[model samples]
Target: MLTPVLIVLGSYFIGGVPVAYLTGWLLRGVDIRRYGSGNVGASNVWQSISRAAVVPVGLAEIGQGLLGIVIAKAVDQGLAVQVLAGLAALAGHNWSPFLRLTGGRGVGHAIGFLLILSWPGLGAFVGLSLLGVALRAIPQFVGLGIAVAPLAALAKGQSLEIVAGSAGMAALIIAKRLLGNRLALPPGADPRRVLLNRLLYDRDTHEREAWVRRGQDE
Candidate 1:
């Protein structure tokens, strides 16, 4: 019991390392959130810092998720305990205490957790992701693909723990897509338009360039 609890707590802290923040500060001497869609994730790192920064930030975050799963597995805990550790890691990445409860969208972290549990889950993820790209790269559908991985896990007879953990990651991704960084609309900007852009375009309709943060092909 104590071991599981410690795993959860330790994983949470590991998940909250603020990789993007440090990466940006070290490379450009600026708060990543201040520019490039104001996101504290790999996407923003690519925008404000360098194209190369994205991979490292993503790897660090994914490693955080994997760290939690490894700890759980090391304790020889059952599926339930392992799932809890994974979720704790995701929550920490999504709402990192070090980043004032602001963090990445959890896409990489989700990938890490699912990949560790079941590679087939990633097959669902990739197939859907490629389909979305083939259809002209619609942001909404691409993001919706996240939900498919968990369902695939469930259909494949994975344990409840695996299914729930995948589902949790899907939820975090969808939620992030819907409600991105703190709402800082320019005066007179229609909330409805902003919501549409966030949900569909993955950027502020008004300030697409800043949101793209050098990541998009713009």
Candidate 2:
């Protein structure tokens, strides 16, 4: 029991490392959150700093995720324990202890977890996302594909642990997207409408090109 607990906690700390924020500071001397999407994430790293910065930041987040599951699998002998560890690592990115309990959106971290836990789920996500893109849906709908993959796994009758973990991850990622970066509504916009915009267009209602202006994009 103690060993598993330690593994989960350790993975959380590992996931809490703010690679994107630190990377932006190191390379551009500005807080990554202060520019572009005001997000301490790899995407903002690419938009605000040189595109090359995303490589290391992406590697760091993904590697941390893989490291967490690898440690779990090494310490345990069952899929359940490994799944728990993967969720812990993912939660670390969603609510990182290192950054005052705030963290990135967790897609990159999810990539890492999915790689270690279920490649098929990852493939499902990619395949569905590509299909959505081909349908001319917005980019944010592609994000919905993450949820679709796990639900598809459940439909396929995969093991309980794997299916639950995948679905839980999908829920967390979409929840963050729904929350956007703001805690309060920006007066005049309906809450439901704003959330819908975020879920689809990833911007406020009809505010195209807001991303380029910085501070306006979620």
Candidate 3:
């Protein structure tokens, strides 16, 4: 009993490492949260810092998710515990105590968890998400890909645990997208529209360039 509890807690700390935040500070001596998109995720790292930086930070974030499952598996815990650990990791990455409950969008962490939970689902998500990027309609396609993950797992006849785990991961990602990085809506802005934009575009505004470039001059 104690072992499982420790495993879950360890997974959360692992996922809470804040690799992107450290990367930005190390490379440019700036808080990543104050820069591009104000997100402590790899995409923001890419926009705020260098493409090269994203490689390591992205891999590390994914590894955080992967390690959570690995730790649970290492202890020979059952599937439920493993799924719980994975979800814990996602929760940590999404709302790290180290960052005052602020963190990334959990896309990378979700990828990591799904990779171990169901490769077919992960493949479906990655393929479709990439397709969306290629089509210049990232939010729509990414959301579609996430939405399809559990279905893909179900189609492949994965266990109920795997399907449910995949769905849980999707829920985390969607929730983060909706909540954003704790940025407040502009004064007088329609709360509903801003939330819609966050869900659909991962930003407060529809203009990608403007959103990404915000706070750059500061």
**Winner by lDDT:** 3
Compared with the true structure, what per-residue lDDT tens digits does model 1 show for residues 1-218?
54888988888888878888899889878777777776777867876778888898888888887888887888797777777777788778778899888877776777778778967688888787778778866465657667788888988998887888888878877677667767577568788887778777767674566556543333
Show the colliding residue pairs in model 3. Answer: none
In model 1, how large is the Cα lDDT of residue 144? 66
- Report lDDT (Cα) of residue 34, candidate 2: 57
Whole-model Cα lDDT of every candidate shown, in order: 0.77, 0.74, 0.87
> How many pairs collide in each candidate, listed in order?
1, 0, 0
TM-score of each: 0.88, 0.86, 0.96
Q: Which stretches of candidate 2 lie over 4 Å from their true place?
A: 131-138, 182-187, 204-208, 215-218
lDDT of 3 by residue, 170-209 (tens): 8988898889887877668898999999888888887799
- Ten residues in sequence with the least summed lDDT for candidate 3: 180-189
Candidate 1 off by > 4 Å: 133-138, 213-218
Give me the overall lDDT of model 1: 0.77
lDDT of 2: 0.74
**Candidate 3 regions with alpha-carbon error over 4 angstroms:** none
